[model samples]
Target: MIRLAIAISVVIAVPAWADIAEPSGFRGEPYTAPVPSTLQGAKVIDAEMALTLWAEDAGFVDVYPRTLKPQGLPEGTIWQEPRHDTIPGAIWLWNTGYESLTAEEMQRLEDGLASMTRGNPDMPLVIFCRADCWMSWNAAKRAVDLGYRKVMWFPGGIDEWQDALGPDLVRAEPVAP
Candidate 1:
């Protein structure tokens, strides 16, 4: 009787410890075609696809984290192309990735994007960051929310870019250093 009672208690206690939450809300959803999987309504693509699109004159954009409070970025923490050569016409938009951004900041980013694109909404814009980074995800979402329909997210980011394109393709060093 005691043994059964102890077993029951152990089983009851085990559930509390066993409840482990997933990180970054990663759902492991299978990749589907036609519409590109997204983090938050933003179209996401792989590095290979982005490269192909860029080669075809599709406008690509990089949404990166900012070290500075606003506008300016800290030294050594800016986004760069794998070959130090961006996708010809790619633009860099620094969005610090703070938990919350002010309305003014959002407007600034929108205005910058508008100016960069020359008011062309049809221009293709690709957003990227290191793999598994939620920063890019959030940035992409914000872009979509702002009515930028041509935005694309590069999920593989720098790591996959280097692995597939070789060392010569990697121009930007890791920021953690």
Candidate 2:
């Protein structure tokens, strides 16, 4: 009788299974999906699969964190060289990132997505940068909101890509040696 009672309690304690609550990355922040349910269908992929399948044909956008260059150092600030770059074929668009974007930034994001669509909502768009980065999540969600039928979120972004495919695979963007 005690064994059965314990089994029943354990079953009751188990949370009901559900689709990934946050289809975007699992970061609770200014960038969590406003309507997480709507993100139910967003495809999430890794760098290897992305490179093998959609790398060549998808509208890849790099949502990597832009290195914020500090102006006028206070003194003795340890400033390390920013290692920022996009995947070989990913488009680098500034201000298309951030969970809380200004009106103009949002506009640019929408415009860029629309330009990629070119009236075809079914165009597969892959957005990524770093693993678990909120920037990519917000951007991909914005794409889906813009009626992009094929929105893919590469959670394992450039970091994973370089780890899997090597540094030679990425392209040095706006700033690099």
Candidate 3:
């Protein structure tokens, strides 16, 4: 649980760069066509397809940046509840500096992903987070480039899943480091 808390805190705290929950580090990727049409081997799927793959224990990655608190609240303002959820069994993948992962971080990401998929390179890995969010797009692309072979990107994100599976059906996991 300590690890989880640290992850949440990191996601919430904004760096010296961008404002709001919008990822400050990397914003280089395009938001349109959240899913790439020509990903070579990776497949872009919808919420429904994501569920289908989950039944087979496919890996699910949540690249959404978590928002813990709003900035500059009034002196007596009460904080509103924050909503940052992932699909069932989704792992919170952090978004760092323009998706330009370091060699160590890249290895760690690849290793975590492999562990999630039980070290099976051919296993399907489903990734999602927010609608039109480049974080997820870049992560999905990176996963494919890592030779995962069965990388899947769900473009609609948490909102998409909530819309399709009803709001309550969606699940949440603490953002990971």
Candidate 4:
């Protein structure tokens, strides 16, 4: 009877589950979806707030995944990589937001953050991708994990930026570590 009672208590103590529950680690694929309202260690901001930060010269990072050219294609086939545009002065940190990353990939993110923040963990660094995208969420969480003191997550990413500002975004290339 005590065993059954303990089991019931455990079940009752469990929090209600939601489809968009924020996991302790990076979110998995189907990267576009609803995100949690808060990121524990970082500030979650909207487009207007992002603009304010931009005006303050905060470092912005675009974590939207880059499409890699397929391998084993016919030699005669032509391929063009997709172009990504971001907020002016925002650095593109391509492919660093995946749930799983190799050691080298993790190094890239660390190095990029270190460079952008000028080795100051307290610098205001904003990380983003697109509205409803978890890539930004993952990246922002990773930044917090890396000891960034002023990490801001612009969850409403480029979509919100374009709506709030204008179509004034510029093409960006990923920065080297």
The model with the greatest lDDT is 4
Candidate 2, 129-165: lDDT as tens digits: 6765667777787777778888888877777887886
Candidate 1 per-residue lDDT, tens place, 111-150, comes to 7567656788667767766666555565666667677778
Q: Candidate 1 or 2, higher TM-score?
A: 2
Number of the top TM-score candidate: 4
- TM-score of model number 3: 0.65
Q: What is the lDDT of residue 90 in candidate 4?
A: 89
Candidate 1, lDDT over the whole model: 0.56
Q: State how far residue 123 of model 4 sits from its true place (Å).
A: 0.3
Q: Tell me which of candidates 1 and 4 scores higher on TM-score.
A: 4
By descending TM-score, how would the candidates be arranged?
Answer: 4, 2, 3, 1
Candidate 3: stretches off by over 4 Å: 1-38, 66-83, 102-105, 166-171
Superposed model 2: Cα runs more than 4 Å off: 1-20, 23-39, 68-83, 166-177
Score each candidate by Cα lDDT: 0.56, 0.67, 0.67, 0.88
Candidate 3 lDDT, 1-177, residue by residue in tens: 999999999999766444324332344755432333334456878878877887777888876655665788879988765655567777766542136776755665676687788888888888776776666767777787678888888877778877887335444654444
Locate the minimum summed-lDDT window of 10 residues in model 3.
17-26
Cα deviation at 48, candidate 2, in Å, is 3.0
